[model samples]
Target: MILYIKYMVSLRCKILVKDELIKLGLHYVIVDLGTVEILENITQQQHDELKKSLLKSGLELLDDKKSILIEKIKAVIIEMVHYAEELPVTNYSNYISDKLGYDYTYLSNTFSEVKGVNIQQFIILHKIEKVKELLLYDDLNLTEIAYKLHYSSVSHLSNQFKKITGLSPSYFKKIKMKRSGNLENT
Candidate 1:
């Protein structure tokens, strides 16, 4: 049985889910982002227990088909943006369609309806967040960050960064440095 989880986007969330499954004595075959496959049929008691336990941690057990599908899309996007070592060379639409085995139009429409943002916009937002994280690390230059995230060029990254954050990358970096007491870096 495949169980879908809402907000299972991070390593910590995955660990929390595994711990919950273990506590429930539920044998799980696989636990990936937003999903868990179990080896046995779940009784209502077990399901409710798991659901209640997960809820205590701010996670949710998804039930309806649309919610599951939407969570799946979110999981894929989160993995792609925040976790993947390299972004796919293919366009976002095709990458998402192939990942979810649904037509891009359906996925796009569903995501827009549920999230109030198109998938591409969602990707941009996530990418910008990742950019901010990388900047905080002070490990990579803007060019390298742009290349790692597969931006067409530094200008493209800067444009999207400004659009999403209302601050240019350099200005954002300066703010972070000043806040961290590294004014010399700024």
Candidate 2:
């Protein structure tokens, strides 16, 4: 049986879920982001126990088809933005469509309806967060960040950063550095 889970976006979450499954004596064939495939069908009692255990860790077992699809969409996007070694050369829509085996229009409409934002907007938000993380690391220049994140140009990245953060990238970095310095002194 394939189980869809919400908030299973990180490696830590996978470990937690795997541990819980082991404790419950459930044999899982695979545990990937937002999904778990079991070797055998679980009884309702086992399912309820697992659900309760997972709830304590802030993960949710999705029962509805729509919710499962939505979580799958989110998992794919999260993986692409945060964990992918390199961005795909094709358009993101095509990549997502091929990955999920759903029509792009259908996926976009479903995502917008469930999330109150388009998939493109979600990608941009994740990209901005990634940019902020990279800046905090102080490891790369704006041009490098833009190229790594697949932004067209540094100016494009700067404009979007300013629009979303209400601060220029340099100002944001300075603020973060000041905060870090304060923490070190105290």
Candidate 3:
């Protein structure tokens, strides 16, 4: 049985889901960013109990097809932004459409209708958060960060970063404040 979980974003979230499955005596084959594959099908009682437990921790087991699709979109975007070492030179719309096997326009429209933000805006938000992470690590220069995140140039990266964050990348790094992504989505 496969279960889609909404709001499971981090490695810690994966751990929490795994622990919950174990506590419920459910054997899971795999637990990825936003979904879990169980070795055996679950009973209604077990499913209800799991749902309640997950809700307490701010996670919800997605049952609707549309919600599941939205979660898949979120998972792919999150993975690309946070975990991938590099992004393609092509535009993100083409990349995402090819990856998800759907028309870019359809996906973007659905995402915006469901999430109240355009896909590009979401990508920018995630990319900005990635920039914040790299800056905090102090292992890469602005140029390198721009390249890794697929920005055209350091200036472009800085421009977008400032537009989104209201602070230049250098200024942000100097301030050393704990920066983060969109809380509702991330």
Model 2 residue runs over 4 Å out of place are none
**Per-residue alpha-carbon lDDT of model 3 for 147-184, expressed as tens digits?**
89988899999999999999999999877743433443
Model 3 spans > 4 angstroms off: 177-186
TM-score of 1: 0.92
* Per-candidate clash tally: 0, 0, 0
Q: Per-residue CA lDDT of candidate 1, range 59-136, in tens?
A: 999998988988888888998898888888898899999999999999999989888899888888899999999998
Cα deviation at 98, candidate 2, in Å, is 0.8
How high a TM-score does candidate 3 get?
0.87
Model 1: colliding residue pairs = none
lDDT of each: 0.91, 0.92, 0.88
Look at candidate 2 and tell me the lDDT of residue 15. 94
RMSD of each: 2.4, 1.2, 5.6
lDDT of 2 by residue, 11-103 (tens): 799999999999999999999988999998999999999999999999998898989998888888889988897878798999999999999
TM-score of each: 0.92, 0.95, 0.87
Say what the RMSD of model 3 is.
5.6
